[model samples]
Target: MTEGSLPRLELWCELQCPDCRTALDDVRALRERYGDALPIVLRHFPLEKHKHAYAAAEAAEEAFVQGRGWPFVEAVLARVTELERRGPELLVEVAGELGLDAEEVELALIDGRHTLAVDADQAEGKAIGVSGTPTYVVAGQRLDGGKSQQGLRERIVALLEG
Candidate 1:
C-alpha cells in the first residue's frame, strides 16, 4: 500500500502532562498491532499550565532531529515529575542517556531552532480544536483522550477498517 493510503493518528501531546504518559499505552498498542501500516504522528501542544512544557517540546524536536523521536518522547514522558524539577537539565540528561549528544541537545535548547516547528504544531493543534493534551485525531475525527482513553483504540480501528 502507498504511504498515503495508511491511516494516520496525530497525538496532540504535552511532554509534561501525565495524561499524555498514560495515553502512551494506547500508542504502544496501536504500534504493536498495525506497525508501519499506521502512522502515529506526535504533535506538540504545550499547555500554558506546565512551566517546562514548551522547553520540553523543543527538546523533543531536537531529539527527533537527532533521530530518536519516540524513544526520547517516552523517556521524557516517563519522568514528568523530574522534568518539572530539573527543567532543561532533565532534557539534556535524557538525551545523553539515549546516546544523543548531550551538549548538542543543550545547544539546541539554547539556540531555540526548533521553536517554530513546535509553535506551528501547537497552532495547528489549536486550529483543530485541540485544547488539551492527549487528544487524538484519526480519519478526520477528533478523539479527546485527555480525561479518558476508553474505547479510543476501538474507535480508531473501526475508522481504519470502515
Candidate 2:
C-alpha cells in the first residue's frame, strides 16, 4: 500500500443510539465529500441498553442483501426518535418508504436471520475497544469522536496521507 492512501475506515455504530444517529450524518457528509475514496464500513455495535437495536442491526444486513444497506441505515437512523416506541416495526416502515420488501424485512426481523452477523460484528467491536456507538476506526486507530465531523475528516485525511 502507498503512503498517500486511506486505510480501512469503519464506523462501529448502532441504529438505535441517538449519538450514532447524529454521527450518521457526519459519516454521510464524509462519504459525500470523498465518495469511493473513503468508504465508511458500518459495523453493528448495538448497545444492550437499546432494546430495539439488535433487530435493527439484523434488518440492516437483510437490506444489504437487497442492495440497500446504507439507505436502510439512513432511513432507520432518520427515525432515531421512534426506535424504542416502534421496535422492529420501524424498520419495516423504513423499508416500505424505500420501496423495499417490507414483509421480507419484517420476516427477517422476526426470524432474526441476521442475528449471527450482528453478534459477530458486536463481538469484533468489543474486541477492539468499541463499547460505545459512533466509534470510527481508521488504519488501526480507534476514534470515539462521536459527532465531531472535523475530527473524523482530519483523521481520514491523515490516514490517506500517511
List TM-scores for all candidates, in order.
Answer: 0.95, 0.91
- Residues 39-64 of candidate 1: C-alpha lDDT, one tens digit per residue: 88999999999999999999999899
Instruction: Return the TM-score for candidate 2, rounded to 2 decimals.
Output: 0.91
lDDT of 2 by residue, 40-74 (tens): 78899998889988999999999998889999998
Per-candidate RMSD, Å: 1.6, 1.8
lDDT of each: 0.91, 0.83
Look at candidate 2 and give me any clashing residue pairs: none
- Name the runs in model 1 displaced over 4 angstroms: 1-4
User: Clashes per prediction?
Assistant: 0, 0
C-alpha lDDT (0 to 100) for residue 17 of candidate 1: 98
